[model samples]
Target: MRTAYSVEMVRAAERELMARLPDGVLMQRAAAGLAAACADVLGRVYGRRVVLLVGSGDNGADALYAGARLARRGAGVTAVLLAPDRTHPEALAALRRAGGRTVPGADAEEPLRRADLVVDGIVGIGGTGGLRPDAAALVDVIGETRAAVVAVDLPSGVEADTGEVHGSAVRADLTVTFGAHKPGLLVDPAREYAGSVRLVDIGLAFPGEAELEALQHADVARLLPVPAAESDKYRRGVVGIAAGSSRYPGAAVLAVAGALRGGAGAVRYVGPAGDAVLARFPETLVSTGTPEQAGRVQAWVVGPGAGDDADAVAAVLGTDVPVLVDADGLRLADRDAVRARRAPTLLTPHAGEAAALLGVAREEVEGARLRAVRELAERYAATVLLKGSTTLVASPGDGPVRVNPTGTGWLATAGSGDVLSGLAGSLLAAGLDALDAGSVGAYLHGLAGRRAADGAPVGAHDVAEAVREAWRDVTD
Candidate 1:
């Protein structure tokens, strides 16, 4: 897993390491790593014109020291000190000792435009709101320049803890971060500003508290359930799906289409569209009554195009099995009813449905997906998978929120969500917890969607068909 440490946790880790090391050792390590990355980007650091946008804190110190390294290697380095008086004294002296020159504000623009590369050191984890007036002006100048910009630590003015952009932030072509990854480096808004992130280890070990995290292929592959040699159909797990109506029989087919390939031992279909589901997948155990009448199942997938079928929804919600609620089911769900369930509950809602659950506007949910997913998990007391361009799975407990790295725009086709709900519910049935089921399901679904389309348009059935291939990619 790719872990993200919060600013507070990073600070504590820095403090602990600082106490054990020499003064400025951590900063020097950070600077050296940053300088090497900069040199790689510049191809040949010697004879290159580099401009360092220095702020008032240790972030500026990092840039100044890195600039000094480049200067000693034959690059012409100039530092534009935003706060000269408050600038790091040792770092400033180091830069001068290495043949680096400082230019006042009035002389900054020309040098910045003419430089081959620019280093942004405007803010670090200690930064509050957006760029100050002077910093904004400097950023605007950098924005207009043709030089590639590299940000020290994170892109300035981004919320390291939440991935929220405070105000106007510098858009760096590359960001060299220290210690560990920040939430902003992986999530959106801030992620858009942070182009490519490279982590520089400063030997600061964080024992606890990871604010954000992204699951790697290995992590997902490990968490995915696989059948043993002695496992039989009944011994593995059965997933019961309650979905579709006469008006939307295709939803049931699509849901079953996904459930069949979800590593489940068996799939039980309980709804009005039993014939439709049977037509699609003859292996599925089709039932004509409510979800309760479908007998025992390890998990349940509820609310995919059931229309206004409150009775079926209630029956599914009433079950003691782990349940994944999605699509139209999100609209009819009672927050208290979901909360009262004995088994683990997983909610999969697109931005619009998530907004309804939160009683907020869709724009609000989309604007801050991280906050919305967390709030939804907290409000309903269940794991929530907020699906969109970037699928996020949030649990109410501690640890980093999961951001799915595998997704394509093609996954937004009709009935795609039903497939996802069924897949996740099947995983839950196969004994994965709510969070793992949702995230793994989403990851596979996205990969399947991409493979199904292959840059062209594909219907929901194609995505379902590609699940096996996606699974192979993960498992193999």
Candidate 2:
């Protein structure tokens, strides 16, 4: 698993490491790594024009020290001082000693245009909101340049804790993060600004749980349920899907399609679309009744293409087994009832649905997804899987929020979310907790979408059919 720490945690770890080491040792280590990364980006560093956007913080010192290293290597390095008066004195001196000169921010346009690489150190993790007018002007100049940009730590103007980008921010081709990964670097919005990220070990030790966790292949493989030879169909687990109506019968077919391949022993579908579902999947145990009458199911999935089926939503919520509520169920499910349930309840909502639940606009949810998902989980007392470019699963407790790293734009198809709802519901039946089920389901769903699409457009059924392929790829 890939983990990210909050700025406060990172600072504490940094302070502890710095206390044990000699003075200036940590900064030098960061500078060495930064210089090496810059050299790699330049390919042939000799005679390359490198520009460093210097500021008043430690990041500015890092960039300046890295510029000195490049200068010694025959690259013509120049530091464009955003804060000329407050620049790191020792770093500036070191740059001059190594034959690198400084240029004022006012005269930066010419050098920025001619630069082969631009190092962004205008702001660091401590800086918040957007860039100041002077820094913004310099960044505006850098924007027009064809130079490949490298940011120190994280891209400037993006929130370090929650991946929110306010106004003007530096868009980097690559970001060299020190010590640990920030939450901003792993999520979207800010993640989009950070192009590609490389973590440099600066000897800081994180003591406890990370603020954010992203599951990798090994983690997912460990979480996936594999049946033993003695296990029967009922022993493996049965998932009950309460979805589809007269108007949208395809939703039932798609949901069952996903559940059939989710490592579950059997899929029991209870809905008004019984005929349609049976026609598509004869293996499904179909019933035209409420979830309670669907026999002994280990878990239930409700609310895909359910339309105005409020009774079905309420019935599924009342069941003792773990439940996944999505789509129309997100609208119909009572908050008090959901909070009162003893079993685990997972709520999956898109940005629009989440906004409706939060009484906010859709843009607000999209911009601050981490905050929105956390708020929803706390309010409903359930695990929330906010679906988007970066799917996030947040539980009610103080545990780390899980972020799905695998995803593709091709997942934005109709009925794709229905497939996810069933897959996660099946995992829930297979005995994984709400958080694990939601995150693992998202990981497989994303990989399946990528496999199905393969850079081309595909339907939701194609994605469902590819889940087996995704599972094989993971376990293989």
Candidate 3:
């Protein structure tokens, strides 16, 4: 699994390492890594034109030092110092000795326009808000240039902690980060600015825990609910899906399709679309009654095109078994009912549904997905899986938030989320906690979506069928 440390955690690690080392040793190590990454990007560094956007912090100092290295290797490096007087004196002298020159931020247009590469050192983790007026103008100049931009640590004007990009920010084709991954580089808004990222180890020790975690194949494989020789249909687990209506019978079919592949022994679908579900997946035990009368189930997936059936959603929530609420369920379920549940509750919401829950604008939820999910999780005292380009799972507890890395744009199609709810609920039935079930389910669903689409448009059914392939690939 890949992990991201918070700024505070990173700084503490850096400080501890720096205290043990000789003065300037850590910075040199960082600069050496930064320079190497830049060299790789440029391919041919000799006689190449490189522009550096230098600020007042250590990030700027690292850029200056890296530029000095590039200058010594025969690159024509020019540092555009945003705060000239506050620049690192030692780094400035080192750059000049290595045959590099400086340009004021005011007269940066010419050098930036003619550059083959640009290095962004304007803001690091310490800085807050968006770009300053002068820096914003310089970013505009960088945009007009054909230079391949590389940011140090993080792109300027991005919320390093939250991945929130406000106003103007530097957009880099590559970012060479030091120590460990920041939350911004792995998330959206800030993630979009950082095109491709390379982590340069500076020998700083990270904490055992980080602010965020992204699971890989090995992690997901371990979390998957594989059956034993002794396991039977009832012993494995049953997933009850309370979904669809006569008007939207496909929802029940789609949910059942997903639940069948979710490692559950049986799928007991209780809804108005029993005939529809049986038509598609005959293995599903269809029920036309309420969730309470649907016999025994290890877990319940409530509301996906159930229309205005709030009573069904309430009944499912009242059950002692783990429950996953999505779609019309998110719209109809009472907040108090969700909070009062003694069993594990997982809420799956898209940006619009999340907005309704938070009483905020859709743009607000979309822009700050991390905050919205965490807030919702804390408020509801449950696990929240915010479904979008980047699927995030956050619980009300102290563990690191899980950010799913496997997703494709084609997943934006209709009924995709309905498939996800059933899959995760089935995982919950198979004995994974809310966090594990949601995170693992998302990982598989995204990979399945990718395999199903393969650069073409795929229906939700195709995506559901591909889950078995995704599971095989993971286990293999």
Candidate 4:
């Protein structure tokens, strides 16, 4: 897993390292790592012109020290100190000793325009709101230049804790962050500003808990369900799916389509459209009774297309196993009853359903997906998977929200959600927790959808058929 700490945690970690090491040791290490990355980008540092956009604070110091390194290596280095008097004294002295000169004003724009590369050190973690007037003007000049930009720490002006961009920030081609990753580097809005991220270990030991994390392929591979040699159909896990009606029998087929590919041992279908479900996948066991009468199941998936079926919703929720609620189930839910349930509940809602649950408008939910997912999790006291362009899964208790980065717009077909619910419910039955189950299911679903579409418009059945291929890719 790729772990991300909050800004406060990063500061605390830096302080702890600073106290133990010699004065300026951490900054030296950061600068050395940064300079090495710059050298790699410049190919041969000798005879190359480099411009550093200096601001006040340690971020500027990092740039100044890096410039000194490049100057000593035969590069033509210059620092444009935005705050001349406030520039880091030690860094300025070192730069001057290495034959680097300081230029004044946006007049330094000419040097930047002529430079081979630009180092954006305008703001750091201490920065608040947006760019100052002078800084914004400098950024405008830098943007007009053709030099590749490398940002120190995060791209300036982005919220380190959340991924929100309050004001204009530099868009860097490469961002070199010290110690560990920040939330903004992994999330949207701000992530868009950070083209690519590189982490430099300054040997800072952080003993505190992480606030956010992004799961890598290896992490997802480990969490996937694998059957044992002694395993049987019942031992593997049974997933009960209660979905569809006469009005929407396709929902039942789509949901079952997803369930059959899930690593679950068996899929039990219950509802009015059992015939439709069985017709698509003969492997599924069909039942005409309620979800409770569908016999014992490790997990239950409710509410894909049971339109206004109060009895169906109640029967599914009445069970004590892990439950996944989606679509019509979201609207017909009794909030109090859902909260009062003993089993783990996973709520999957698109923008419209999420709006109704949060008592906000759909636009509000879509505008800020991170906030919407968190709000839904906190309000329902359940794991929430807010489906959209960027699908987010958050649990009320703790941990960083899991963002699905593998989906395409082509997945927006009819009955696609039903497949997701079934896949997630299967993972739950396979004994994964609500958060892991939801995130893993989304990862697999997205991979499947991508394979099924392959740059063409695909139906729900194609997505269902592609799940096996996606599973193979993950397990292999």
**Local accuracy by lDDT, each model:** 0.90, 0.93, 0.93, 0.87
Compute each candidate's TM-score over C-alphas: 0.94, 0.99, 0.99, 0.90
User: Compared with the true structure, what per-residue lDDT tens digits does model 3 show for residues 240-311?
Assistant: 999999888888888888899999999999999998888888899988788999999999999999999999
Worst 10 residues of 2 by lDDT: 285-294
| Cα RMSD (angstroms) for every candidate in the order listed | 1.9, 0.9, 0.9, 2.8
TM-score of candidate 3 against the unseen true structure: 0.99
- TM-score (C-alpha) between model 2 and the true structure: 0.99
Let me know the TM-score candidate 4 reaches against the reference structure.
0.90
Instruction: Determine the backbone clash count of candidate 2.
Output: 0
Per-residue lDDT tens digits for candidate 2, residues 216-265, read: 99999999999999999999899999999898888888989989988889
Instruction: List where candidate 3 sits over 4 angstroms from the true fold.
Output: none
lDDT of 1 by residue, 261-351 (tens): 8878999998889888888799999988778878789999989989998887788888888999998888888889998987999999999
Superposed Cα RMSD, model 4: 2.8
Clashing pairs in model 2, backbone N/Cα/C closer than 3 A: none
The order by descending lDDT is: 2, 3, 1, 4
Clashing pairs in 4: none
Off-target runs (Cα >4 Å) in candidate 1 are: 453-458
